[model samples]
Each structure stands twice: as C-alpha cells, then as structure tokens.
Target: MSQYFHSVTLNKEKCKGCTNCIKRCPTEAIRVRNGKAKIIKERCIDCGECIRVCPYHAKKAVTDPFENIYNYKYKVALPAPTLYGQFKNVWDINLILTGLKHIGFDDVFEVARAAEIVTLATKRIINSKKLQKPIISSACPAVVRLITVRFPNLVKNVIPIQSPMEVAARMVKRNISKKMGYKTEDIGVFFITPCAAKVTSSQIPIGLDTSLVDGVISMKEVYLKLVPILDKIDHVENLSCAGMIGISWANSGGESTALENEQNIAVDGIHNVIKVLEELEDEKLSDINFVEALACTGGCVGGPLTVENNFVAKNKITRMAKLISNTAVNDISNTLETVDVSWTNPITYKPILNLDNDMIKAMKKMESLEKIYNDLPGLDCGSCGAPSCRALAEDIVRGFANETDCIFKLREKVRGLAREMMELEGEMPPPFRKNEE
Candidate 1:
C-alpha cells in the first residue's frame, strides 16, 4: 500500500544485521541499521537478492495465500513456465496444467503461451522499427525496475512490451469473462510466481496503472500443494497451450532463442546483468539486436522462491522442450495473433538515485560526495554497515553516517586517543615526589 509495493520484506527479529545482503544487492537498496536490514522504498527493485542471501531466513517474499482464491466467485491459475520445470521427470505439460485444477483452481493458464506471443510481437517490432541497438527485454520486472532506478538513459532501449505473465493474465481474464458471462472483478487471476519481483509487478505494474493479475502465489508454496495431487488426477486435461519454444523461457538464453535473432544475447544473474548493461550503455554492443537480461542465474527457474536447483531445473526444461512437437510453436503463435496482448501503457523514468531536485545543488552534492569518497579508504569492507567505502562516503554526505563510522577510521581514532593518554601519563609528576621535596 506504500508508494511502491514490494514483495520482499525483512523480519527484524531474525536479522543479525549482517552485511551479506547489503553487498549482494544489485541496486544497493539495503542498509543495515539498529541491528536490522532496511529496504529503501524508492531504491528497491524487489529482486529478492536479500532473501536469497539472508542466512537467518529473515528476508521473505509476501505472497497471497492459497485460501485467498476462495474470495472470488471464480479462480484462474496463471503458472509461470518455470513451474513446469520444477517438477522432476514430468515431460507431459498437460499433467502439470491439470494438476493445478485438481489442487483447487477453476481454471489454469500458462504464461508461456503469452511468452510465445511476446516473441512474435518482439520479432515484428525488431524488424519494423529502427529501434535502438541492443533492445533490452522487458520480461524481467526486476531488470526493468533496475533500469528505471539506476540506468534511466537505457529506459528508451527497453522493448515496449508487457511481460508474458501480465499478457497471460490479461488474455485469461478477458477470455474467461467473455466466455462465462462473468464480470472481470468476479474472477480472480493468480500468478504462480517464481520470484518476488513478479509478485511486486503483479501488485504495482511498471508501465501500467493497474495489474491484470489479482494475486500472486510463490512457486515454493504451490509446489508443495500441487505435489500431493500431481499424479493422482484421474483425467489429465489437454490444456497444454504453449509450445516448447514458449516453455523454454524458464531457462537462461531461452527468450533469445525464441526471438530467433542471431545477434541477440541472454545474460542472467543480477550482477552479470549489470555488467552487460554497463557495456551496452557504453555503446560497446551497438551491433547487438537484443539483450535478454534475467535477474536470477538460470532465469525464472533459479528464482529465490523456487524449490528446485536452477541447473537441474534447466536440464528438466530442456528435456521437456525437446520432446514436444516442433509444429506446436506455429500453432501457438497463430493463436496469439487474435489476442490483444500489445503493451499500450508508457514507462516513465524513476530518478530515485538523483542527488537533489535542483540541478545546481545536485552538481554541488556530487562534487562533495567525490571529495569525501577520495578521503576514505577504497576498501569495500562493509564494517561501516554500508556496502562499500564509497557508499559510506555517500551516506556521510547525505547525513546518514560519519567518516568515523568506518572501522579503519575508528581504529585510527582509538590509536590516537591511546597515544595521547600515554603522553599525558609520561608528563605527569611522580607520585608525591614534588610534595615530599
């Protein structure tokens, strides 16, 4: 309900005030203070890196409970493609789709179907418009938010397309409402999410004013619920709508593969994505056609909320993709053309990292920040409760901390005090010597 809706949150009681999260955070949104981790609302992209790194399980993603589905007259389960990869030895996609219905859903929808549509739409956009080189994929909400926060200059390069999850939610809601003669609000569309970023996206959409999805459920929770009913279904419905190409979006390089662009590159892991984005920002990859940047290491399958190991999940997804018929891609692509899946809303830049609202003052602050940074030890040790020495310098300039907060600086101060005490002791008169004389 805050200005920014974040799925990731901290449990203050469980936090040990460790610097693990502060250092790993891609956007540097986390800071440790008062023996707890605090998320900066404006800076947080909800990438779930903190949740992944927290040793005490203090960081958690807020997801809708399974029982929340009963609040609506109808419920639709929108499962991410990564959901299919979570199960072991389950090559039959239909079994997983049917499993959701058995687990208490009125209907099931595959976000992968929408991914296929996005692929087609993206290809058309790439071929039609003289788009900026290395067009960034908008599929990863975390990556999109990262650009909005840190790389405003690269916002224009983001492909103007809704994510597969959003598209699928819209498509499912519209189709179900029309077919069943039910109002949009009467039906609840739940996205079975693999990561916190998708949960945040469902609640506070980036480009749009409102999200089509009604709720989000974590994959880890859904996996637990669905496993008991996975193999018990008497009738496996033929509800597999997405092809292998679409389903392949679960793993790294899958989107680029679907786009079929020779010059496209797919990079995963938030840190690696940052490096690639920096290179792209420098115009080093001007000849590249597209950049598919996923925040997790192995794409959605490697989401912090997932149960399966990312590498194992990727292998499972690859095997399943290969077993499916090749013609299914064309079939799904054709069906997607009939749906209104294009993104109409505009994305605005968020200057969260801006030093000040005033241009002149901001410049002055920047100069002062650099001067402070140069004075501090360049070691990126997080002893100051900041990610790095540079971050500590920035915090000092922003009035959040002082240079003495640095352990090395504090050590020097302590040494100076000790030296002064020693000198004073040496200069002091011998006990009662002057009085006796």
Candidate 2:
C-alpha cells in the first residue's frame, strides 16, 4: 500500500472536539476522541472540508513556505486560474502574473494557459474515443480520491488526462530549461494552490507517480504577499497567455462551457458532486457526455485556502472572463500530440470502507456490524463522535470505538447498573443489627 501524506491536519490545542469535522467529512474519515479530532489515514481525501467547517480553526492545510522557493536555482510560479479571482477590482490577469514575479519567482507560468491546452486535449479525447457514459473529469484530486474510497466502480469513468497544473509545470520546466540553459532539476515549478487537495496531490500525485510541480503554496498565504505588490507594479511586461476559456475554469461550469458539449453537466461542492457521481454510478445519467465535478463550491475560487468569498470571487472571474478573448494559442494539437497526457499507472480502488481484507472475515465483520448497527438508536446524533450510528458501528468493529461511546447506550447501561445496585442493597443484611447486639 502507498503511504498517504495528508495536507489537512488537526491542531490539538485549538480543537474543541465538537463533532463538526466528523459530521462534515464525506468519507467519515474523522473521529473526535479524547477531546481532539483524529483523521483516518486511509480514508482522508484531503478535501479540506474539515478545515472549512471547523469553528475553532483547528484544522489546517500544511503548505510549503515562500522561503522554500530559494531551494531551487531557478523558480517558476504556476498560478492556478483561481489566483486571478483573488484580487478585487483587478481585471487584467497580467497584473497577478507579474505580482508573482515581484514575490521572488524567476518566471511565471499560468496554469490557466495549460488549462486551455487541457480543454483542447479533452475535447479531442471526447471526439476520438467512445468512452464510458458521463465521463468524469480527472481535474479535481479530491473528487478522484473520493471515487477511489467511496465509489471505486466509477474509477474507470474518470478521464485519464493529466491536470492543468501538471501539464503547465511540465511545459514551463521544459521551455525554461531550453531557453536559459538551466537543467530541469534547477528549475523548480511551484503551484499556487487554492486547497489542501492540491497540496496533497503535489506531494503524492494520484495518476502520476511524481508531480511536476515541486511545492505548493496556499493561495491565502500568497494573497497576503501579492496584494501589496499588485498596485506597486506600474507596467506588466508579460501579458497573460491564457484566454477567457481557460481563465473561466476558476468558477463552476467553466470546464463544461469550454468543452462546448451540450450534454455535459457541471457539479460543484463535494456533496453535490458525490450525489451526481452516485447518480452516474446508478446509470441514471448515461445520456450525459461529460461530468465536471469540482470538490469546492463555485470551483477552485471557493477553495478553503482562498482569501475571497467564493460567490464574490466567482463574480469577479465571470466579469474578467468576459473581457478576455480566446486568443492565446489557437492550436494545442501539436503539444497534445507530443505530450503523454494519459495516466502512466493504473488507479485502483481503495477498500477503506470494507470491514476486512479477507472475504470471509469481511463478511463476518459485516454481519457483526449490521447487528451492532441494528442495536443502536440509529439517530445519527453524532454524540459518539462518529457521523452516524452505522459509522459508529463500523468504528466499533474496527476497534476504534465501543458501544459505550453512544450516549443512549451509555445511559441505558448506567440505568441497568443502578437498578442492580438497588436490588443488591435490598438483599443485604441490615447494618444496624450488629449495633443492636
């Protein structure tokens, strides 16, 4: 099994263990125990939902510090399309790209430009191949992980194309190396990420064995440094290479729109995506040609690490996208033709939710789990730190929790013990008999 490296982590000091994260976690990957939130290593998808919903700011995404850029001889900033949506009242994308250079990057590459290439590549694939119905986009790492853990059957439906970030990283590194006579190793490509999923993806890629981007810097962290410099730079020497089609990818429905497919559906927010994926798995949406599922609401702009409000940022991106034209590069076919966009390795299902590795043992455990679940109150009250009664039963079978953790069960047990104590007291010899003698 591959070792999991999660971006989302708990800060023990800040966690109130109020069951907020456990309730919100789609995969039931979290449990509140001993007054702290614990993430199950096998089940965590790094969706950053816990980080977003945590009231006490206990959940955090681990990202590379800005100073880590100095580790490379040559640094390139691969800004996500969502980064353009961060700055309020800024329409020109070049200003944001240039601002990255001011922050100490040797060169700036737009992940959006690579998004344009991906758009073209995806279109080509859709046209050429008779793929499974409602082919899911492989762009969202969190969604991919979700499918792996929860809906393993739909893994085949996921498009095998590399993400825009990876494509851009490869292109930028190769181009920079050729131009500046620098080795590819010397040129470090850092992705300016909008969520913890991207951080985890960069560290341990899903489809690919290694990520082209060297490090991931959270958008919230970069926003602080970029905003002050956005105004200071008078003239942006390097204009944005990506057009509206690519830049619109920051918001929901952008990818579907770019695909120009009438039968495509775009779903945002992890829960909504899960619902749609469930429908797809049930073969309910076979008519649809494609499914653009973004883990974050309103797409990348709404990511947990982003500084701006998702709705507001989406509006800004929409407004900016209107002004920009699709004039970047008319033909990405040549690049797509040469590049290896397909997955190098196969993506297998992760049976994290399964009771056991052994079929017989798993079946036995399932029977026990069902029995335990039936015995519970089935309120899904989350009082026991698990999301639902079923989840608590699973935890109990897994030895992470017991029936006593359930408040109702504990209450009933306490009442039974009290009754037994009363019955034993009634049967006991009178204490005053010795004093009378």
Candidate 3:
C-alpha cells in the first residue's frame, strides 16, 4: 500500500551501527543491530535525515538511470526547479534543457511549467473555500505524507491538487504528442527530481494511482552526468517556460507569493513545519490565510538529491527570479487550457489509516495495543524492527512481532527467568572436586 519505497538504504557492510541516525530520525526509523543500522521502511518518511547524518555515507537513494529515456519512442525530461541550482553561472535555463539532449533526452519539459498550474489551482482553492484559514500546500510529498501519518487532523487543510511535477508530465505528453503527431503512449516523460519523495510521488501519487510521469532520475544522478556537458552546450534556446511565480516554487514561501495572498505565512525545515503544524492543530494559527510548509529548508533547493550548497542554491534561485517576468499564478491558468489537463479521479485520495471503518474492532485493537505499549522500554531503539517502542507495540497487535521480543524487556525477563530457575533447583549438592586446586 506504500506508494513506492523511497527511503534511504544502508550498505550494511559500511554502517558503523551508530545511534546518530536514530536520535535524529523524526519517526525513529533507524535501529542498530548486529553492529549495523537497519531501516524500517514502513515507518520511514523518506525525508533522508539518515542519509544526511550518516558518518560513513552508507545510505544512498535509488534513482532511475538516464538510459530509461529510451523506453519510449519519444522522451521528455521534466526537470524540477531545483535542478537549475546544480550549475554555476547557468543564467539561461534552456542550457540545461539542451544539455539533457546531449545527455540523450529527445525533449525537455520544465516541472516549473506544471508548478504554474498548481499555483493557480491552489490560489483558486484558497479563494473559493468556505472553510478555515491557513490552507496548506500539498506539493511536497514528504510534508504531505507526514501529515497523513502523524497529523491526520490537518488533512482537510491540505489543498487537494496535483503536484507541479505531475502536471508537467501530463502537459508535456499532451502538448508534445499533439505537436509531433504522435500518440500519448509513444511519449515518455521523465521527472528530473530533487529527492526520493518526488520519486515516490511519481510512482504513487496521493490522490491518484497511475502517475503522469513515466520515470524519475534524481538530481544527484543527473548532476554527475550533466556537469561536464553544461558548459559545452552553446546552441541553447531561451526557453522562458516559467515566469517568476513558477520559478519561485523552488524556494520557501514560493507558493504563497505565487498565489498573491497577503495574509499567508511560509515556513521551511522539518522541525519548523512540525511546530507550525502543531500550532495549527491547537487552532492557534487560525488567523493566517495560507501556510506554505516545506519539510526541507529553502524548499526544494534543500532536498536530499541536490548537490549545491543550500544557501548558495537559494541565492542563485533568488537572483534568477529577478530576471524573469513576475507573472501572477492567476495569469498562468490561461496556458493550461490548451493542454490536456484531465486527471484520474480519487486514486490518490484514500485514507491511509485503518482506524475505524469498523469502530468496534478498531477500538478493541487500540485498547489491547495501548496496554502493550505501556509495558515497553520507551527507548525506540529499533532493535525489534519496528521504528519505535510504540510502533513495535502496534506491530505486536498487528501480529508482526511479539511483545517479549524487545531486547530491553527481553533482558529483564531473562533475569527473572534466571531467578526462577535457581529457586526451582532447591538446595545445591556439594562439589566433589578439591577446593585447594
């Protein structure tokens, strides 16, 4: 039921079994075992905090290869707005697009273009909704997934619109197919993404099942292949695919400004977003009209796949914003009309919690699991293969692990077992061997 496995993986041999990742994980997703760290896939949010903190650099995200472009008759590379920051002095965005051509892509599509549509959709929703203030952006998959798992109460605040990457893939396929006289099936749209979350988003879109994207290549992989070719591409066109509103999607508060809302607030970084979300839950932030919360600081520029310094990339994006036209998101909606913008309905919109389609069964499970959780060590050491002590208890109730399997509790039980065994032995027999030896 997971969209795709986008979490960081360990090179078991390289892992030093350190507790650094365990302490840093928001979800307590890593556990040290047999002198190596193991990932709890179901609990991992794919935020890549483990990859960032790992001393040996044993953690790596799996990405699609560039050769995947050949899977279709025609291929289009949809680069995330963050990909632009990977280069130095790359004033022209088309240089990177053309560079994709040199690297084997037949065509290039900007995810920023799709961002334009999302910007409009979100603005429309914000303006039209009769509900509460502080509409949350659903563009960042990690932030979205975090809400689904940890903060289900805020789900209604999440604007239910397709992410910019999805929109770009759909648009490019439709427009290019129409322009080139080819069928939609003949075109392959690959998103050049910034993190594992986007890869997961492409594989399993939240509100939809089949994604518009055909494949995904991370920024880390793309940068390795494109660095040498960046300067060599001399015949690049001036793409101008996205305006300021679209380009701003790469940074913090980008969506808020794009929507032209005066009362909105934007916060970046996972901890910061969590604090704001907590405030939202308490109804303390009810006055704000919109809340743009990104799990990564500096927005997509700080995503795990990006190679450039976050501060440096943020500056570059800021500088780039000044050169482009400052078109509002409302203006960009006109462009989407010509493109085939239909979406597969309700695929990504299901509730992830099994909580109580049947309330009686769910309540009984919760009560039994609550008692088990109370007995746990609360260390969240991940030794039992669940992410945390509470998660381990849930797993026990779910029938994946037994309550006694927790190493801390097991050691305690073993001590009690030893005492019981000694008591059962009664009086001990005298030794036959000589004590002088």
Which ranges of candidate 1 are over 4 A from the true structure?
A: 327-338, 421-437
Candidate 3 on 351-409: residue-level lDDT in tens?
Answer: 43454457798898899889999999888776675668887777677676787779988
Alpha-carbon error at 302 in model 3, in Å?
1.0
Q: Is candidate 1 or candidate 2 better by lDDT?
A: 2
In angstroms, how far off is 332's CA in candidate 1?
Answer: 4.8
Please report, as a residue range, the 10-residue window in candidate 3 with the lowest summed lDDT.
341-350
Candidate 2 overall lDDT versus native: 0.89
Candidate 2 vs. true structure, TM-score? 0.96
- True-vs-predicted CA distance for residue 267, candidate 2, Å: 0.3
Higher-TM-score candidate of 2 and 3: 2
Worst 10 residues of 2 by lDDT: 428-437
Tens-digit per-residue lDDT, 1-437, candidate 1: 56878999988889999899999998888888887888888899988888898899999999999899999889999999899888876778899999999888999988988888888888888988756767999999999999888887799999888899888988888889989998999999999999999989988887777889999999999999988888788898999877787889999999999888799999999999999999888898888999999999999999998998999999999988888765455665665677765667767788877778898988988899999898888888897889998888778877888889988888999999999999987675667355455
Q: Which regions of candidate 3 deviate over 4 angstroms?
A: 1-10, 29-41, 130-132, 327-331, 339-426, 429-437
What TM-score do all the candidates reach, one by one?
0.94, 0.96, 0.84
Best by lDDT: 2
Give the Cα-based TM-score of candidate 3 against the true structure: 0.84
